[model samples]
Target: MNFDYTLAFAKELDQADPLASLRKDFLFPKQNGEQFIYLCGNSLGLQPKAAREVLEQQMANWENLAVEGWFEGEDPWMFYHKELKSLMAPIVGASPLEVCPMNTLTVNLHLLMVSFYKPQPGRFKIIMEAGAFPSDQYAIESQVRFHGYDPKEAIIEVSPRAGEYTLHTEDIIAQIAEHGAEIALVLFGGVNYFTGQWFDMEAITKAGHAAGALVGFDLAHAAGNVPLKLHDWDIDFACWCSYKYQNAGPGGISGIFVHEKHFTDTSLNRFAGWWGYQEAQRFKMEKGFVPEAGADGWQVSCTQVMPMALYHASLKIFEKAGFMETLRIKSETLTAYLIFAVNQVNKELGFEQFKVITPTEAADRGAQVSIIAKDKGKEIFQQLVAHQVLGDWREPNVIRLSPVPLYNSFEDVFKTAELMLKISKEILI
Candidate 1:
């Protein structure tokens, strides 16, 4: 579909957008008395207006009930995460029994690894993306070390072809086929954080399984940004943080998915805690760990009610907006418009110096458009921020702008591009 990004066209698009009113539900950050065109949802999402009330209610419960709040509050702290299962399940395409809200991303990754990363005598290797997020790299490295394996020998780090910014799907499948028998686990980010490329989860899972390895995903960037089918894809496990695209505030609760096939696998070992013990026997002060029946079995500690409240607030908005499908439609169009405008600017500048590192195909990417300005990249980024076009800067040279469909508009994309063109001519040139 051809998009004419004129101001009138933008206005007309907004006028017809069914999700336009959802923007008013968020609190946009302002600078110089004007709202910034927020394109940073890939880093941190704008806070929902409902989050204030949700957080306040938790504060009120704490003030009135104190320690008793665990069982006595309106939304009991003891079972706080339970309230989020239904809301989060659909977002990730999993059954409620397969999903659980819990610890931070890396922490949950480690916990899931404990159960999923059982390496046999000769076949104990882990496969992952080479430029994975630092936290994930550290976690995987530490897990290999903790298991008395040399990471250099036991971990396979897949990289893009020389001089490429993204990994090709064919390369990934070929790699799996070549080393499938020796691999124990295949762990990768569902959508790479830096490149904003969405991997083929189902395809990856199938390849891993065909090679006799368990598969998992670190969905920190993918969750709420791209549509997922964890259960249907037959993925073994997955984990994600809520602070980014989920808009659940900083360091909010993370989530996990454990396939039903592993639900009753007693041989699948885990680092158990009291919370993971069977609820009926939990209060009995049991001597042995009797795990919960499904994904909830992975819980190691009690839920943090405050952060759970914040997550609830955001999930409510997701539920109201019809979740992934609706947001995805807006996200694809908005990102396409931003890409179009940026390319136009580069053409007008008479130099194809700006390169979009993120994949052009909508199915291969999410909302983020990662651009590398060949020269004066940082200067261009600073100019964009100064012009109230908020984006994030990665090391060396990438400028990542994410047009979150829930809060960002087509006009915001237009104005952001207009500002970029102005900045490039005046300062970057």
Candidate 2:
């Protein structure tokens, strides 16, 4: 794909984009009356324009129907999640029955672990990537400790080879096989949050199953940003937050996926609650819990109507743009263009000022491009933000910029690079 470092070229690409009109659906942030070229969807998505109306409607339901809101209204609170299930399933490539909108990411992870992370006498170890999100590290450590095993001894972290920032699929597979006999579970992020490397989920799932372990993922950065096939890939279970690429607002509702195969596994454990009771007999208030027949059974509390309303507004945007397949096509090209633009910046500056750490291969990454700016990295990042080319800066010297296909344009990418090059020249000279 030939690319030119010109604003006209970027506008030409934008004009040719099929999903261009979809950008109008979101509300971008403004700083001092200047609309930002938001490129931080990997951290938090921009708000959907419809979010307020949807939230108001739910608030009205609570006001008008009061207690009756549970069973009344166009979308009954009791079954609101069903509508979300239908919309969410296509994004992750799973049956509606296999996915459920429920608690936030780590909470769902903990609940799913109770069912899937069974530590047998000999098989008591958990294998995960070395630098997973901090919450995951805490959860896995506590889970191992709860089972009376030393975390240092029971947790196996697959690390990148020396001097490398990402894991190779073969290395990950070999580690799983090496620890196959004693491994109880294999958990990894769908995309590493720091480097934005999309893991080979299908290969990892196959390896985990062959190694006699249950596999799962923390998809905080992957869901809606990348195409996934959780069901077809034979993933036992997975969980994700919606605030990132899904544009579900800050701390939006998270969801879980449980393969239909696990629905009938009576040995599985769950921290049962009233909402999880079989719907038909829920009014009877039976003393014993008969879990709902599908992923809904995993629900511990009743519907979070307000958060779900916001999430529903965003899912509608996804449905309007079709599914992940279409979005992924644009994502690949958009991210590639960012990489190319950054390279162009280096060429113009006569040095590798911005070193991209994220994989350039489309299949191995999603929307994020993490770069390390030499010498004045933090200053460059601050300048980007000040100039409204909004991206996030991490500790030391990393900047994570994600060009989300839903709202970002090629012009945004071009201007970002243009500004970066100018900033570099000013700072270095």
Candidate 3:
């Protein structure tokens, strides 16, 4: 699929896009008077237009039904999460019973670790990627410390080879096997937040199991950005935040997946609460905690109505767009065009001013394209924003841009690269 770096070409592509109408479903941010070319969906997705309507409905329920809203409303708050499970399961490739929307990502990770991260005499270590998102690092560190083990010795970090920015699959597998003997769990992000590299989850899961360890993923960046098969992959557990690619609003509700195979395992420990108790007997205020069947058993508290409403709005859009596989087709082409446009910028300047650090293959990456600016990176990024080309900047010199298939058109990508080229020229001069 050859790509041209012309606005006319971009418009032509957008004109033929089947999902083009879906763009109107969101409200883009504005700087000055013009709408921004938002390429920061990897960091924070734009708000869905339906967000207001859904939120108001829930608010109205609170006004009209009062406390009885839990059971009396059209969409009862008591079983609200059940409505979401069917929508969310398709995003992560799981059955309805295998996924549940509950606590935030790290919070769910902590709960899952309590059940799966059982460190024993010979196996007390956890293996993970180096430079993981700080929350994961902190959570794993704290968990190891809580079990009376020093993090330095109990955690094994797999790093990229010298001078390389992304990890190789074989290297990751080797690390798992190398530490297999003492490893109790293997955890990794489905797609790295910094590099946008989509790790091979099935491969990792198989390796983790072969090494006699439970496997889990933090899919904060991967959910709705790429196609996942958590259930088919035989992953032990996984969790994700909905704010980014899922577009569920800032600090939106998070979800968890526990394989159906683990559903009846009574030996598994959990921080139990009334919300997770057997639904029929919950009103009886039973003595011992009896967890509900399936992934709902992992719930530590009752449903979050407002946040779930926000998430439902976005999931409906995904449903309208025909879910992840449909979106992935556009995302691959859109992301490829981004890489091409950035490469064109460097070619026109007769120097590699912007270096793309993400994997080139669509199979190994998602919508995000992280680039390292060779000169005046921060200045260039600031100017891009000032000019209404909104992308995000990381520490050091990386600028992250994500052309979300659901909202961002090809013209948005083209215009952003054009502004970046102009900014780079001005900064270098």
Candidate 4:
């Protein structure tokens, strides 16, 4: 598909889009009394218009039902999180029993580590990509230290080859094999938050399992951006925050997936709470902690009703949009167009003024395409923001832009490119 960066072409494609109508689902942010061309879904997704009603309904439950809201209202607080399981299962390609919504991403990561990342005598190392999200880095380091080992010896970081920005699959597999003997766990982000590189989970899982290690993923950026098959891939455990791609508001509910293969593994330990006690005997407040049948056994607290309501609103929109594969189709074309338009700006300058560091291969990346300006990346980012192009900038020299398929239209991408090219001439070039 040859993409044209002309104004007419952008508008024509948008006019013909089947998913165009879906943009109405979100409430785009306005600046100077006009809507900004928002391209920061990678950081935080736009709010679903239906969110207000969901919140209001929850408020009504509080006002009308009072203490009885726990079990009597339209959506009872006692079992509200249960309602979201089947709705969100398809987003990560897991069965209802294997998935549950709970604590934040890093919290769930800590809980899962308690069960999966048991470093023993011979196998006491962990392998991960070098520049993971800072929180993940901290979590792994703390976990390793808590086990009474130095991080320098216990955490093995797999870096890219010289001058490369992304990891090649072969190198990742080789790294796993090289350290296979001493590694106990292989934890990775489903998509790198900075580079937007989507790892091959199935291959990674196979390699980790063959290496006699358990595998898991932090899907903060990948959950709604790409199709995943946690169960089919045989992942041991996984967790994701809903605020980014799932569009559940800031610091929204997080989800976890634990394989049914671990359902009866009594050897595994959990930081037990009454919420994790067997449902039928939970009210008895018994002395012993009997776990629930599946992934819900990992849940340790009462559900946060409002946050789950916000998440449910977005899940309904996801169901309305059909499968995640459908969204990926539009995301690929839109992000590819962004790459082309960014390149065209450089081509017009008769040099590579901006280099896109994100992988060009569709399978290797999701919605974001990270751009590095030759001389003025920060200035270029500021200019885009001033023009109401809502993209975020990273440290050093990278500008990250994501033309989300949900709320961003082709014309938004076109206008962004036009403004960027114009700004390059007026300021950058």
Per-prediction TM-score, please? Answer: 0.98, 0.99, 0.99, 0.99
Error of 1 at 28 (Å): 1.0
**Runs in model 4 lying further than 4 Å from the true structure:** none
lDDT of 3 by residue, 1-429 (tens): 988999999999999899999999999999899999999999899999999999999999999999999999799999999989999999999999999999899999999999999999889999999989999999999999999999999999989899999999999999999989999999999999999999998999999999999999999999999999999999999999999999999999999999999999989999999999999899899699999999999998999999999999999999999999999999999999999999999987879999999999999999999999888899999999999998899989999999999999999999998988888887885
Scored against the true structure, residue 335 in model 3 reaches a CA lDDT of 93
Query: Per-residue CA lDDT of candidate 2, range 89-163, in tens?
Result: 999999999999998999999999999999999999999999999999999999999999999999999999999
lDDT (10s digit) by residue, model 4, range 64-154: 9988998896678988888899988999999999999998999999999999999998899999988999999999999999999899999
Candidate 3 or 4, higher TM-score? 3
What's the best-to-worst order under lDDT?
3, 2, 1, 4
In model 3, which range of ten residues has the least summed lDDT?
A: 420-429
List clash counts for every candidate, in order.
Answer: 0, 0, 0, 0
- Count of backbone collisions within predicted model 2: 0
Q: CA lDDT of 328 in candidate 2? A: 91
Model 3, backbone clash pairs (residues 3+ apart or across chains), number: 0
Top-scoring candidate (lDDT): 3
Model 4 TM-score, 2 decimals: 0.99
